[model samples]
Target: MLDGQSFLISRAVPGSCEQESKWIYMTQHLLESSSNKRPPSQESEEQEQGDRGKRKKSPECPDTPDITDTEHALDLSDRQGSDGDYDDANSFINPLGRDITISCLLRCSRSDYGVIASLNQSFRSLIRSGVLYKLRRQMGITEHWVYFSCNVLEWEAYDPYRGRWIAIPKMPPNECFMCSDKESLAVGTELLVFGKEVTSHIVLRYSMLTNSWSPGIVMNSPRCLFGSASLGEKAIIAGGTDAQGTILSSAELYNSETQTWETLPAMNRARKLCSGVFMDGKFYVIGGMASNTEVLTCGEEYDLNRRSWTVIPNMSAGLNGASGAPPLVAVVNNELYAADYAEKEVRKYDKENNAWITLGKLPERSVSMNGWGLAFRACGERLIVIGGPRGSMGGTIELNSWIPNEGPPEWNIIASKQSGSFVYNCAVMGC
Candidate 1:
C-alpha cells in the first residue's frame, strides 16, 4: 500500500487580488443607504481630483487573460482547441441587456458554456474573446464546481449551489497522464489534470467551454508523485521522483496560453512526495523526501519575477509517512494554514513568528484514516475537504466545507457517500 507520502495533494490555484477590486466595487455599492448615485462632486472617483491629491487611487483592474489557438496542430500530438468557446460572438443579452449582466448570467451555468456557444455566432464571439470572464470579474460573480477523481477511472463533480453530485465524462485512459501521485486544479474555467504517463509526463485538459476532454500541451519533465499549484494563469511543478524513481530538484512553469513549458532553476533540494503552493505572488515548494525516510524538514519559496528560491523555516511537523496523503494547507487572507497531521489538528504557519498555531481539529474520522487520499482544497471562497479510507479496502467517504472568511470558521458536512474512490486528486473549476 502507498504510504502517507503518496497522499500528497496536488494543490489548488491560489486566488489573486486582480479580482478583489471588482468585488469591493460591488460590495461597496450594496452597502450604500440610498439607491440613487451620489453627486459627482461627492463621489470618490480617482480621476476627479480630491483635496488630498488623486484620492489615493484604487488598484486598476487587470487585463483580460488570453487563450491562443493553432489551426493545424497535429505536429503537436497532445493539443486540442474549441473554435467558438472563446470567440467574440459570445453570450446572450442579459435581462438588463448589459454585457456585464449577460456575462454574469453566462458564468452561473458554465456547464452550459459549450451548449450556449453553439447557439449563435454572437455568443461564440463574446465567449471566445475572454470578455465574458472579464465581465464576470467586473460583476464579482464567482461559480465553482468541485471535481473528484477516484481510483477506478471514475470522475464526479459536486455543484455547491445546486447541492448535488454532477456527472462528468469518465476518466480518459491509462495511457495518458497518471495521477497515482497527482496534482489537479482549475485554471479559469478549465480543470487541468497534471500527472505523468507512468514515466512519460503529460497534462489532460477538460474544458468547461467545450464540455470535452482533450490532451494538453506538454511537460518539460514527466515525473509523477510531484507537487503542483496554479499561479498567475499558469501551473508550477516542483520536486518529485522521475521515471526511474529518482528524486528530483528541477522544476518548471506551464503556460496554457502559449502551450509552452519553461523550465525554472532547480530547487535547493531534491524532493519527491512534496507539495507546492502559490501564496503572496510567489510559489513555495514545501516538505518532501530526498531519500528513503530522509524527510526535508524545511522548504523553499520561489519569486516568479526574480526567478529565485529562498529557504524558509522548517515546518513544525512534516507529513506523516504512514498517513498515505499530503498534509493539507490553505491560504486565507494571504496567511498560510496547514493541517498538522502529527498533532491531529489544523494549524496556520506564522512566518514572522516561525511557528505553527492550531486552529482546529481534523474531522472525527479523518485522523484515524492515515490521510489516505485525504484532500483539503480551496473552492471559491471556502475550502472543501474530501476523502476516507482507501475505497478499495471498502468504507464510506466524507465531504466537508468551510468558509474561513467567516470569523471563527466552522466546518459543515457537505455530504457523504457509501461508495467512493480512493481519491487520486480533486480541484475546483470556476468562472
Candidate 2:
C-alpha cells in the first residue's frame, strides 16, 4: 500500500511521484510580499477607532494583536529558519512542493480554508495571499455563501453546500449606526454594510480572509438606500438620495481588488429606493421614487462595454408601491426573477414582452412589512426566500429555497433558527 504522503501526492497530481516532483514552487517573494502586510481595511479601522472613541470589547470580537506585532514575529521566524531552526516548516507543506500543495488545497472545500490557515505560518501566508482564491476562480471552482443580519449588531453566514451555519464577528457598537437604516452588499471576499452615523454615513466591512470587521471606504457620493449589485470582484451602486436628502442620478463602481470607487456616468432620471441586478451581461436599475412624491415606473440599463445607459419605459410597471421597500429582485442564469411581496407570489421578467409573468406563490408562512424585512435573492442555482413566519410567539427566521426548472415552484425548508422576525440586511457571496 502507498504511504500517507505518497497517497496525498497521488490524489493531488494524479500520477507517479516523479510527476508530482516536477511541479515547480510558486515564487516565494511574491507569496510573502502579498501576505505579509495587513489588509488596508484593518489598518484604516485602527485609525478610525482612535479618532472615534475607545471601543468596548465584546466576546465575539476579542482584541487581536496588531498586524505590526504579527510581522515582528514573522521576522523572527525568518531569521530562525535561516539558522535551520524551522527549515521544513517554512514551506507550505513539509516535503511536497508548493505547486502540488496548492493543487490539493484548491480542491478542498472553502469552509476548511479558515481552519487550514490556523495550522502554521506558511499555511496562513498562502491563504492570505489571495492567490489560491484567484486561481480557483480561473478554474471556475466556486461556492456560494449567504450573509445576513437578523439583529442590529449580529450577522450570520450559511454555507448551502455544507449545510453549516457560521457566526460572524459582531459589528462595533455605535448608537447612530445601530438605529439607522442600512443596506448590504457582498463583493469579492468582503461584505460591506452601509449605514448613517449621526450626520455622515459609514461603511463597515467584514473580510472573509481575516474573519474580522473593519471600517470600509466610503463611496464618492456617500448616499443611502441605493440600488446595488455585484458581479465577481466588483459591485456597482446607483440612484439613491444624497445626505442632503436630494434624489441623485449619480452612480459609482467599486473594485474590491483595488479597494477603490470609480465614478460612473449618471442615469437619465434621478431616483431612490430602487433595485439593481446584472442580467444578460448588463446592469439594470429599476423602480424607485423620482422624488418624495413621484414614483418612477421606468428602468435604466447600463452597458459596460458601451459605457452608457438606456432608459426602458414601463419596465418596472407595478413593481414598486408608494411606500414599500425596493422591489425584491435577483438574477439567475441571466434571467430576472422578483418577489411580489404584496401579492405573495414569484414572478419572472419577460424581456421580450416587457412584462412580468407569475410563476407561483411565495412561502405561505413567510411574512414581511411592505416588503421591508424580507430577502429574496438568487443563491447560485436556487431562488432563496428568507423571512419569519407570521404569528410566531417569540420569533423564528426560516430559509426556503427552490431550484427553477420547467415546472412550477416547490420550495424546500433548508434551515430555521430563533431570531428577530425581521431581517435587517442580506447579501450572497459567491467565491
Model number with the top lDDT: 2
User: What digit string (tens of lDDT, one per residue) describes model 1 on residues 1-431?
Assistant: 00001011111223443443453444333223112221111211111111221112223333323322311221222211365232222222322222443423332334334433443444443445444554444333445667787654666777665455655666587744443555676665567776666446666787654456788776677676677776434778888777688888999887654657899999988887777777777888877777877767777899989999888757625654632455567664456777665566777787887777767876656534456566776665566677655445676667787766425447788777765535667776555
Q: Per-prediction TM-score, please?
A: 0.71, 0.81
* Candidate 2 clashing pairs, residues 3+ apart or interchain: none
TM-score of 1: 0.71
Full-model lDDT, candidate 1: 0.58
Question: Candidate 2's residue-wise lDDT over 1-431, tens digit each?
Answer: 00011111112222223321122223233334334432211221111111122212111111111222223222234222554423643344434444546665665556767755654555665566566666555544556778899888899888766677777879999999999889999988899999998799899999887778999999998999899999878899998877788889999999987899999999999999999998877889999999877889999999999999999999888788888989999887678889999999999999999999999999987899999889998887778999987564778889999877777789888888888878889999877
Alpha carbon lDDT at 117, candidate 2: 64
- The alpha-carbon deviation from the true structure for residue 4 of candidate 2, after best TM-score superposition, in angstroms, is 35
Q: Mark the regions of model 1 whose C-alpha exceeds 4 Å error after superposition.
A: 1-115, 124-131, 134-141, 175-180, 195-199, 322-324, 367-369, 388-394, 405-409
